[model samples]
Target: MLGGLWEWWRRRRLLVDASFAAPLLLLAVFYQGELDQGIYGFPGVGFLGYWALHAGLLLPLVWRRRWPRATFAIIALACFGQWLLHVPLMAGDVAVLYGLYTVTAYCSFRWSLAAVLVTLLGAVLEAAQLANLPREFRWAVMFLSAVCVGVWLLGLHMRTRRAYLRSLEERAERLERERGNELQVARAAERARIARELHDVVAHNVSVIVVQADGAAFTLDTDPDRARKALETISETGRTALAEMRRLVGVLRENAHESGDGYAPQPGVEQLAELVDQMHRSGLPVTLTVDGTPIEVSEGRQLTIFRVVQEALTNTLKHGGPRAAARVTVRYAPDAIEVRVSDDGRGAAAPDDGRGHGLVGMRERVAVYGGRVRAAPRPGGGFEVIARIPVREEART
Candidate 1:
């Protein structure tokens, strides 16, 4: 209940306004009473008129923030009018200090400085008038001047602090937006990568299955034994495609199951021979040669090499003429691994705009390992793809 009441009080603007106005109103009343007792001589303004002026000076403070410059102007004018009439200063005159502070805190700096100067002049004038009075009251000008400067300084400090806090909040919001944008970009790149992997795995195997199925159907009556062999090749190709598809699907369903059963290790350079045999069965005569002793390679870099070779051979099968043949070479160096896949096909005649998805995927994969890839038509009649990937000793182990 107390928390609810506190929240209610905090939200009520009228209560806040009254909190400030009531105290000054009581001070004005007290000063009026003192004047009535003949403690400070008035300038012939009757009791009612003096009280009315004091009320005007003190009540406007309720709306000081709503109309800061206007409120300060009204209060300053009232104080100057009272001084011009030679009325004795009262405690109600202290409201001018609050007016100066409000203008500095809520209004622009130029207006606030203008109020400061005006208040300073008023203080000097009051001091000049009281200068010839008594020794005990001579400190009035210095005291009022100090109060005005101190209030303005406090208001300026508050304004600077509020601006600084606002800037910090804006900076935090900007960084959050940038972080969200970076995540979106990363997600998009990953999705594209998965699409390319699926394409490389499925397209190659499906193409071979289609070719073997056609061959089996064509030779079934004329050569029963050859037809049986083609059927067997089709079955093997389909199973390999299915296994790869399951692995790709598992990657897509990440975190869906914790058993790790759905995931399979990605193919690497060690599987290059099996890949070449598959292509040979698909009626593409392909050969692989290795130079230098084999070295341990990170799974990621190995995958990059495998994909480069797979994509090159897939392009050859799709676009290379029936008699096309391919050769793959891997050279291991102390600091790098190099792969080359070249096909003696009708590549120069194949229509390609150099923007095929397979080529783009190969480049993206190689770039992940800070590798360089080149794919271009050879001078005579074939297509060639070469990739060189740098390796770190730690990664090799």
Candidate 2:
């Protein structure tokens, strides 16, 4: 039931305000003549007198949001004046009651309480003057007290309810934000774990294959049969890597492979040479350099570096001038690997369209590995892309 009401409120906020405002507008029109006649009570005061007094009191209510304290003060004075004159409580005075209640609910408690006390005092004085009762036994006084106290209490309750609803809304929003943050953290951690596993699989397999291929090629001149055997081993190793890659991808629920192990080998830092060789064959002037002995990296960091280099090369091919020269340098230190890719080409210094997903992808990769990327135009006139990946393998896991 509360949910339905909330939905209604959300869907029709303007409608509710309009419905309340229309009646107030109508009341204003009906009482306008009375107000014109009763300004300072000009000649004999009639029903017009009471209506005009209340018109002033209620007129300010239209601007209650702008001047709440002043509106309530006007209402309290009008109500007190009418009580003293024995005006028998005009129907228009009901608007003053609503105004007083609104003031109490929306304004400071001290202000609202002061208004309530003044109204009660006026009610007491009127009852004492008009009611035929002894000072000891005054039912009229009690009735007056009840009326004033009841309005005040009702307004206070409404204020409390409003405050409670506001608190609940703020709390719900805080919890929603916390949940979103937790989900994002969990997702990032999972990706890092998968990346680590993939790196281990790729590096170990690729390194072994490259070693055997080199040895077999060296023997090909003297021993043809052995060379053939070595070539077959290279083929088998390639097939195994491909098979593992497929198997791992199969776990993603895609129907790429009908049978056999679904895991596939994912490339890592070990495949840097292979990547450079492919780009070389594709007609780009590419060079690869390594500083310091290679150290083990978390699968996640390896993947991030591989992707960064791949993206840098891809951008060069798409944007660089013909026969552009590009170089990738990886400096492996004790704690981190700093990679720098620079290209001497015309398109290198041009601005990116800002729509390419590659930049976003690179950022996400670096963010996961607790790394940073800087892509800018070099002082010598070309584009340089640099990525630094920390080597906290345990932290990545």
Number of the top candidate by TM-score? Answer: 1
Superposed model 2: Cα runs more than 4 Å off: 1-44, 64-67, 83-86, 135-137, 210-224, 235-397
The lDDT of each candidate is 0.80, 0.70
The alpha-carbon deviation from the true structure for residue 380 of candidate 1, after best TM-score superposition, in angstroms, is 67
lDDT of 2 by residue, 9-97 (tens): 76774454345445755665565555566643323346567557757665666666556678767877776776656655444455555
- lDDT (Cα, tens digit) per residue for candidate 1, span 1-397: 9999999987886567658777777877787777779886787688886877787687778787778888888999899888888877776787888889888887789988999999999998888877776663458877878988999999899888888998999998997897667655555455456544554656677888899999999999999999999999899778667644643543332233344332244688999999999999999999999998999765556777998899899999989889999999999999999999999998779876433467666776676556889999999889999999887622321
lDDT, candidate 2, residue 165?
A: 98
Candidate 2 least-lDDT 10 residues: 247-256
TM-score of each prediction: 0.55, 0.48
For residue 127, model 1's alpha carbon misses the true position, in angstroms, by 1.0
Positional deviation of residue 98's Cα in model 2 after best superposition, in angstroms:
1.3
> What would the TM-score be for candidate 1 when compared with the true structure?
0.55
Positional deviation of 271 in candidate 1, in angstroms? 11
